[model samples]
Target: MKSPENLLKSFFAERIKGLVQSDIRRMSRECERLGGINLGQGICDQPVPDSVKEAAKSAIDRDRSIYSKFEGIDPLRERIAAKMADYNGIRCDPDREVVVTVGSTGGFVAACLAFVEPGDEVILFSPFYGYHRNILSLCEATLRFVTLHPPNWSFDPADLERSFTEKTAAVIINTPSNPCGKVFSRQELILIASLCQKHGALAITDEIYEYILYGEHRHVSIGSLPGMEERTITLSGFSKTYNMTGWRLGYAVGAAPLMEKIGLLNDLLYICAPTPLQHAVMAAFDLPPSYYDQLCADYARKLEMTCAACDEAGIRPLLPQGAYYLLADISGLGLSDDKEAANFLLGRAGVASVPGTSFYADPEDGRQQVRLCFAKQDGDLEEACRRLRGIRTARP
Candidate 1:
C-alpha cells in the first residue's frame, strides 16, 4: 500500500533515514541563490601557500600519482610525528602510531567504526559539531551530552563527571571548538583525563583549529596528559592551518593497538588519501614559525572586524578565545528563533549565517543565536561585514 516515495524510503537503512544536509550546507546553497556573502560555512577561501602549490605541481610532474601506503607516505607521517611532538607535546611513533587520513573527518569515522558499537555510550559536549554527533549516531552509539554554557562555553566539572559511567566507551573533545570556540585548559583536560582513566573510556580529540587561536589561549592535546597517552586518539589536518581544504589531507595519532584497527578501517574505506597531495603537504611543515604567528594575527583582526559589525547591527557577539567563528545573540533583533534570525540576515543583509540550533542537542539552548564564520578572504569578509552593518536600514 506504500507510495513510490515511501517504498524508496523503506529501501534505505533506518540509520540514514534521519540524515539530511547540515544547516551549514543548506545556508550556503541559499546564499548562492540570493548572491549573498556566505558566513555560514567554515570554508577557508584564503590562498594556499605558494610553496605548497609548487610542491604539488612538482609531484605531478614527477608522476607521484599512484596510491600511497594505506597509512600514507613515510615522509608525511614523519613530518606529522615531529609536529605532534613539538607542537602538541604528544610523542608518537610515525610507523606505529600515525595514520594519514582522507581528512580529520575521515579519521573520526575510522575511529568511531573501530571502537564504537551498538551498546556503547559516547559522551559528547552539547553545542557539538554536527558531523561528530551524526557520525556517532550512524555507529549506533548512545550519545550522552554535557552542556557547554555560552558567553564562555564552560561546562561544570560535576556535569562532566556525571556523564561518565560503566557504559561509557569514549568521549569526543573538539578544542577551540566550532560554533562557540572554547579552548579546553590544561586543568580541565587533566580532569577529563582522570575521568577517562577512572571509567576506562577512550578519548578522541579533534584539533583541526589548534593553530587559529586568539588572545592568551594555548592549544593542549589530551593525548599528552598523564595516563591518557594510550587511551586517546588525536585528529588534526592541514586544511585549516595551511588553507588546502580541497586537498583532503589529515592524520590520526594514537597508541599502536588502537591505531592498528583504525588504520585497517581507513584502508577499507578510503584505500588511501590522494598521493601527490601527501607529497606536497610536506612543504607546509617547512613554512617558518612566523607564518603561524601571522596566521593568528590575521584571524584576530578578522574577529575584531566581524564582532564590530555585529555590534553595529545590534547583535551581541560572544567573543571567542580561539577559532574563527563568532556566535552572536540575536535576541535584540526581534526574531522568533535562530532560523528566523539567519533568514533575516540573509534576506535583508545579503549575508548568510547558520542557525545556532544546528549546533545543540536541545534546540531551545540556541534559540536566539546564530553562528558566523569569519574565516573568509579579506574582500569577502569585508563585504559581508558591510552588508551586516547595513542590516538596521533593511529592517522591515
Candidate 2:
C-alpha cells in the first residue's frame, strides 16, 4: 500500500495547493529564529486597556464562558451597533444586521463565502492585504486587480471603472492599509463606491485600522456613502483599536438579508466570537475618547523614531497617515530585490521586516519596497532603529 502522504497527492484539492501561511507570520518566525527585533507583523506590544481586562476577569468569574448566540451576545452586539451609528455614520440593527466573527479576517472570509460563487469575478486593489486574496481564491472567484501607483498609491477613476464588469461580485477596500499604510481618501472611496454600484458588486471593506489615524487622515466607510448601505459589508474588530489581537473578536454589518446568510455561515464555521472577550470589548467602547487620542499620540512618536532611523540608514519610507506601518524604499540598498534586502537586514542588522512582494499581485510592483511595523514597545522600537542604522556598514 502507498504511504499516507503519497496517497494524499491525488486527493488534495487544487485550492489547497495555492494556500500557504501568511508571509508576515513567516517573517515573525524568522525574527524569532534569529533572536532579532521583530518589525514584520503589526502586532501591538501595548497592553490591553485595564477596564477591558477587568471586564474579562469579571465575566469569567461569573461563568459566562458558554456559547453565545449565532450572531453574538446581545450586550456586545448592541454596543457594536451603537458604535456603528455614532462613529461610522451608519445604522445597523444588532439583532438582524450584525454577526460577531473570530476576527476581521474571519469576517472577510464569511462575507466572501456568503456572496461569491465559483467563476465569479472579484476586484482587488494591487498591494492589497494578502488574506483577502486567499479567501477569494478559496471561493474560486476570478480576481481582477486594479493597480494603485506608488508614492500616493492612487489610481485613475477610469482605471477603476474599467476593472469592473457585469460578472464582478465584490471589491475589497482596506483603508489605513497594511504593509503600505495608505488610507483611502473619501473622494477615492466615493469613486470606488460608484463603480461597485454601477457593477452591482458587493463592497467588502476591511476597516481594522479604523482608529489608528494620524494628522488629519480620516476613515470613511464606503457603506456610509449615499445609496451604498444596501450593497456594502463593513468588517471591523477590537484587535487593533483595543490591542486585543489574541482575543480574536470582530463583527460584520450589512444589509439584513445578506447579514442573515453571514450569520448562518458564522454558525457553521466559528459559531460565535469568544464569550468572555465579547464581554471585555463591551467595556472597550466605553473608554473615553482621550484613550484613543493618547493612542495616536503614542504611535506618532514611534513612527517618527523609526523614520529617523531609516533616514540614518539612507532609506526613504512612505510616511503613513493612519496606521503603524512603514513601507520603506530599499532600492538604494544595492540589493537585487526587496526579499534579499529583507534577509540582509535580518541577518546583518538583527531586524526583521516583511518583503513588499507579499502585498502585490505582480511581484515587480513590490520589488523595491519592504514593510516594517512600528507598533512595538518603545524600547524594542528604539533597539530596532539602532540596529537598522548599521545595515549599510554591516553588509560586508
Candidate 3:
C-alpha cells in the first residue's frame, strides 16, 4: 500500500500539484516565528480612514449582511465608473461594464477563466507578480516572457513585439509593478496597444497601485488608449489606495460583451464581495484630492528612508518610480543567492524580506536580489530601518 502522502499527491489535480505558498508568505511566517519585523509581504500597515470604518459600522448596524447582486452595489459601481472616467480617462457604463470582485485578484482569475484555454499563448513581463504567473498556469495557458531590465525596469520594444504570435490570446500588464516598482509609461502602453490590435489579442491589466506614485511618474490605463477601450480589462481596488487590504474590495471594467462573461464567472465563484464592506468603500471615493497628495508624500518619505537604510547596509537599492516596494541587489552580502541573503538578513537583523527568486521565471535572474515593502507605520518602519542599518556592523 502507498503511504498517505503518496495517496494525497495522486489525488490532487495536475494544475495544483507543485503549487505551494509563495516565498513572500514563507518569509513572513519565519519572521513571525522569530518575532522579526516583516517587510516581506505588502500588507500596508497603515490606518484605514475613519470615515470608511464608520460607514462599515453604520451598515452593520442597519443589517446590511444579505448577498448583493453579483456585480456589486449600484452606488459603488457608479462611483467606480465616475472615477474611471475622471482619473483613468476610460469612460465606462457602470451598469454594463463593471463587475465588483473579491479583490483585483478575483478580477484577474475571472478574466483568466473567461478568456484563457489550454494551448492558448499569453505574454507576460518577467519579474512579475507571482499570482499572475500562477493563475495563468492554473488555466493552462502557455506563457511567453518579455524581460523588464532593471534600474528603470523598461522592456525592449523589439522583444515585446516578437512575443506576439498567432496563438497569443492575451497579455498581462502590471503597471506600478510589485517587487520591482516599474510604472509603465504612456508611450510604452501605446506600443503595447498597437501590438494587441495587430495580433487580435486582449489586454488584461492590474492597476491596484494606481495612486501610489512617486517623482514625476503617472499611472496610465492602457484601456484608456485610443484603440484599447474594447480590448482591455482594467482591474483595481480600494485595498491599496485606502489602506484597507483586508476589506477585499475590487472591481473590473471593460467593454460590456467581455464583462458579461466575467460577471458570470464572478457570480459562479464568489456570489458577491462582502456586502457591508462594499457600502463602506463608497466613502473612500469621497476623500478629497489632497488625501491622494498626502498619500503619495507619505509613501515618498518611507521610500527615501528605506532606500537609505539599504544603501547603508551595502544592498544597492533600485530606486522605484512608483509603488511601495523596493528591490535591492544582495550580491555584496557574500551569500550564494537571494534565499541565503534573505535568511541572513532575517536571522541577523530581525527584518524579513522576500527572496527575489519569487518574482522571476529563471532562478539566476533573481539570485542576487530581495524585495522589501515600505508600506509600514511610521514607528514600525523606523525600527525596521534601524535594524537593517545594524546589518552593516553585524556582518563578519
Candidate 4:
C-alpha cells in the first residue's frame, strides 16, 4: 500500500476543511464508555419505530435492492410533494420539483453545489447548525450570519436586512433551530421572506425539526408565502422526527429549474439515497398524525426537564420555543471561554455539551454560550441533571 501521506489529496475544499467531527459525539462516547449519562448530539438514542424498520425489512426481503432512480422512485417523490403542499401549503410538481437526498445534510450540500457556485455569498443565523456553514463552505460561498438577540435568542429583522447585499446568493433559515430551539414565528417568516424577495436572493431552509414544535410555535415554511415558493429550497428529513439518523434519507422541494441542478449533484454525489431507506421514509410519512403528536409532547417533556434542572442549578436559559436543544450562558460560572468551560465539564464533571462557537463563522460571537441536546431518555436527563448540579456546586 502507498504511504498514508501520498494517499491523501491536497489541502481539501475550504468548507470541508472548516468542518470537523462534532465534539458532541466525542464527549458522548466517553460518557457512554464511563457509564455516564449523555445529552450530547441531537440523535435520538431510542430505537427506530417498528413500522419503518418493517418497511426496510420488507424491501430487503423482496430483493428490491437495485440503485434507485436518479430523482428517486415516483412514490417517494409524490409522497414528499403532497406532504409539503398539505402541511405548508406550498404546491410543487413531484416529478420536476423534488430531489431525494442522503439526508437533509446531503440535500443542503446538493442545494449549495447547484445554486451557490464559487465565491457566492450564503447567509445564516448565529448559533445555527454547524453543518449549514459546512455545506456553504464546501460550495465556496462567503458566509454571513446575524447574531441572535440577547437573552431571548430570537432574531431581529433589521440585523437580517443589514446582512443582505448584491453579492448575496442565498439565506438559510432554520425554525425550531438548533442551539437555541427558538422557532421563528410567522411574522418573522414574513419579514425574512420579504427581504429575500426584495433582494432577489434564494432562501434555503433547514426544516428537519418542523414536526417537534411546542405550544404556539408553528413551523412556517419560507416558501409558503406568496411568490416565495419558486425561490425557496425547503429541506427536511426523517432523521429526527422518525429517529432514523442512520437511515440517511431526506428530500428537498423547489422550482423545477433549481431542482434540476440539485438532481445532477444528487446523481453524481450520492447516486440516489439508499433504496431501503427511501422505502422506510415512505412508511414514515404515512404514519398516523398521532405519532407526530406524541413525539412533540415527548420532546416538550424533555425540554421542561432540562430547563427545570438549569433553573434548579442556578443557570439561566432563555426558554427554548421548540426543537431539542437549549442554550445556557456560562459567564456566571466565571469562565470567559465557553469552549474551555465545556472541556472542563467534560474532563472534570462528566457533562458532555457542544460549545456554541463551533457553530458560528465568528468564534467570538458564540464564546459565551453552549448548547445541550435534550433528546435523550428520561433517565439520562435525570442522571445528567444530578451530575451537572454537583459540578455547579463544586465550581469556584
Candidate 5:
C-alpha cells in the first residue's frame, strides 16, 4: 500500500515526472499574495483594443459560437496568409499553408508533434523561451544547445556550426528573444539559414515578440530568406501585438504538407481555436500601420523608464532592442544566485521579477541575472519603479 504520491509517481512517465516547474509562476503567486507588483511574466498589462472586443461580441450575437474548422475559421486564415506575405515577406496560400492554433504555444507544440520523431535532435539557442524546451522534451527529441552569450547575446558562427549533427531534425529560433530581448540580425539569420540548409534540417521559429521593436531595429523573418520559406515553420500570435494574450488566437505558416499535418494534430489536441475569438482576431488585421507605430513608440518609453529604474536600484541591465524585457546583472548586489536576488527584491522592494535561471538549460548560466518585464501600464510601471528604487538602501 504505497502513499497516493508514490502511486502517482509510479504511474507517471519520466518525462512528466522529471519536468521542473519554472519559478516564474511560483514568484508570480508570491507577488500576488504580498500585493507586490509582478514584472516576472511577459504579459502585456494593458487592455486589448476595443474594435477586437466588439467583433467578438458581434460574432457571439450572430450565433458564431459553434466549433470552427480545425485549421481555423476561413476568413482568419485568409487574413493571416495576407499578413504573412505583407509583413513577413513569405508568400503562402491561405487554404494550404495556414493553420490557426490555440496560441503560438499551441503552434509550437503542434509543429513538434508533426515533425519530431523519437530520438531526433532539435537545436535550441539557450536563454530560450522556457516553454519551447519543455515541448521538445515531450516530443522525445534530444536537445542540442548553442548558448547565446550575454552582453550582446550573440553566437559565434563556429560554435553554431558544431551544434548540428546527422540526427538534427529542426532548430527553434525565437527572434526578438525573451529574457534578453536580442533581435536576431539579418546576418545572424543568414548564418542560421545556411546551417539548416546544409544539415537538411527545418527551422521552427517563435516570433511571438515580432512587432515589438525599438529604434533602428527591424525584424527580418528567416522564413522570408531565399530558399528558406519551405524549410521554416513560422509560429506567431496576436498576444503581444494587440494585447490579446487571453484571446488564445495564433497560427502556423509553413509548406502545405507540413501545415496539413499540423492541422490534423490540432484536431487531435484542441479540435480548433476558440470560434468567436477567431472572428475577433480578424478585426485586429484592420488596424492601421499607425497603430503598430504607436505601439513601438509607447513601449520604447517604458523600456527607457524601466532601465532608469534599474540604474537607480544598482542593477546593471542590458538595454533591449525589441521586446519589453530587461535582463539585469545581479552580480553587483553581491548575490551569486538569481533566485536569492529575486526573492530579496520581492520581499524587500515589493517588486517581483523572474530569476534568469528559469530561462536557461543550466542554472549556472543565469545564476547572477534577473529578468523584469516592462510591458506594464503607465501607472504600474511608475509604481514598480518607485518600489525598485528602495533596493538601493535595503540590506542584502
Candidate 6:
C-alpha cells in the first residue's frame, strides 16, 4: 500500500506547502519547553482587558449560544462602523459595507481569495508579516517582492513602482509594519494609492496595529485616501488592540458590493464570526479615549526600553515611530547569518527571536537581521536584553 501522505493531491498548490510554520511559534514552543521567557510571538505578555473579559462573561450569561446572520448582527456592526468613522475617519454603512470575520487573519485570507484570481500577481513589501505569504499561496496568487533596505527599513519608490504591473491585482500595506515597526509616511501612502488607482488595482490595508503605535507617528489607512476607500479593504482586530488575541474578533470594511461578495465567501468558510465574541466587540469600541492614550503610552515605554538595550549592544536601531516590534542588525556582532544567530541565542543565551530571514522568501534578502517584539512587560524586556548582551562571539 502507498503511504497516507502520498495520497494527498499531486500538482497541489506549491505555495501552500512552501510556507514555514510561523518561525515565531516554533521558537515560542522551544522556550516554553525550556521554561524561558518568550518574546517571539506578538501575543501580549500582559493581562486580558477586564472590560473584554466582562463582556465575554456577559455574552455567555445572556445565552448567546446560537448561530448568527453570516454578516454579523446590527449592534456589533454599528459599533465597528462608529469606531472606524471616529478613529479611521472613514464613514461606512455597517449593514451594507461591513462583515465580521474570525480575526484580521481571516479577513485577509478571505479578501485575498475574493480579490485575486489564480495566477494574478500581488506585490508584497518586506519584511512583511509572515501570514501574507500563506494567504497569497492559498489564494493561488503569484507574489512579487519589494524589499525594505535597513538600518532604516525604507524602500526606494522607483524600485517599488517598477514592481507594479498590468497583471498586478493588489498592493498590501501593513503599518506600523509587523517586523520593522516602520510606519509609512502620508506621501508614501499617497504615492502607492495613486499608482493603484492609475492601474485599476486594489489596495488592502492591514490596520490591526492601529492602536499599538508609539511616538509621534500615527497609523493611517490607505483607504482613508481621497479616492481609495471604495477599492480598499481595511483589516483590523481586537487581538492586538485589546490584548484579546484569543477572543478572535475582527472586521472587514470596504465598498458594499465587494463586502457583499466577501460576506458570501465568509458564509462558505466560517458561516459568521463566533456569535459571543461578536457581541463582546460592542463593548470594545466604546472604550474611552483615555484607555487608548494609556495603551499607547505603555507601548512607547516598552519601545524605548528595548531599543535602548539594542543601542547599548553597540547596534543603533531605526527608532520606531509606531508598532511594537524593532528589527535589529546582527552583523555588528560579527554574525553573518540571522538563522545561525537566532539558534545560538535560543540554545546558549536563553533568549528567542524571529530570524529576519524567515520573513523573506529569499534568505539572501534579510540574512543579517533579527526581529524582536517589544510587546512585553518591563521585567521580560529587561531580562531578554540582559541575556542578549551576554553574547560573546569570540568563544564560537
Candidate 3, 299-344: lDDT as tens digits: 9999999999999998999988888999999988778899999999
TM-score of each: 0.99, 0.97, 0.99, 0.92, 0.98, 0.94
lDDT of 3: 0.94
Predicted candidate 4: what Cα RMSD to the true structure?
A: 2.7
Better of 5 and 6 by TM-score: 5
Which 10-residue window in model 2 sums to the lowest lDDT? 387-396
Better of 1 and 6 by TM-score: 1
Error of 2 at 72 (Å): 0.5
Q: Which candidate, 2 or 5, has the higher TM-score?
A: 5
The true-versus-predicted C-alpha distance at residue 212 of model 1, in Å, is 0.8
| Residue pairs clashing, model 4 | 15-137, 102-248
Ten contiguous residues with the weakest lDDT in model 4 = 9-18
Candidate 3 Cα misplacement greater than 4 A, ranges: none
Worst 10 residues of 3 by lDDT: 357-366
Candidate 5 C-alpha lDDT tens digits along 255-354: 9999999999999999999998998889999999999999999999999989888888888988777888999988888876899899999999899999
Better of 3 and 4 by lDDT: 3
TM-score of 3: 0.99
Which stretches of candidate 6 lie above 4 Å from their native place? 1-15, 314-316, 392-395
Q: Provide the lDDT at 195 for model 1.
A: 98
Judge candidate 5 against the unseen true structure and give its global Cα lDDT, from 0 to 1: 0.91
Q: C-alpha displacement of 85 in model 1, angstroms?
A: 0.5
Q: For residues 163-275, what per-residue lDDT tens digits would candidate 6 score against the true structure?
A: 89999999988887887877888888999999899888899888888887765777778888899988899989888888878877788999999999889988899998899
Residue 126 lDDT, candidate 3, scale 0-100: 89
